[model samples]
Target: MAWVYLIVAGVLEIGWAVGLKLSHGLSLAKPVHTGLTVAAMAASVILLGLAARSLPIGTAYAIWVGIGAAGTAIAGMYLFDEPATVARIAAIGVIVAGVAALKLVS
Candidate 1:
């Protein structure tokens, strides 16, 4: 259950990150996007806290951030037409590997 929360939180982190891009620096003209971004951010933190109740802080934080960073990079490539270079993909792969290693060790 805690793992589930953590995973969902990580996904929400991706959502908020993408939302930040969409929000255009959180301009007032983009109120909807900004609101949604803020909501996602709050929810993600809350879920992270819930997961932290059971998981080690260092392990949970690393995994959460790893998922967010990797997932956001992928999202940028697909949704925003960002570069999908081999180097970028390899970097994401490394982050995923690290996250997996943390999960295994924890």
Candidate 2:
């Protein structure tokens, strides 16, 4: 259950990251996008806190951030037409590996 919370939180982190990009620096002109981004951000944090109740802070935080970073990078490439170079893909892979390792040890 805690892992579920953490995974959802990490996914919401990706949502907000993409939302932030869509929000155009959170400009008032993009109120809808900005609002959604803020909401997702809040939810992500709340879920992270819940997960941290059982998971170690360091491990949880690292996994949370790792998921966010890797997922956001992938999202950018697909949704925004960002480069899908080998180096970028490899970096994402490394982040995923690190996240898996942390989960295993914890």
Judge candidate 1 against the unseen true structure and give its global Cα lDDT, from 0 to 1.
0.97
Write one digit per residue (lDDT tens) for candidate 2, span 46-104.
99999999999999999999999999999999999999999999999999999999999
Q: Mark the regions of model 1 whose C-alpha exceeds 4 Å error after superposition.
A: none
Please, what is the TM-score per model?
0.98, 0.98
- Which residue pairs show backbone clashes in model 1? none
- Collision count for each candidate, in order: 0, 0
Candidate 2 lDDT:
0.97
Clashing pairs in 2: none
Model 1 Cα shift for residue 37 (angstroms): 0.3
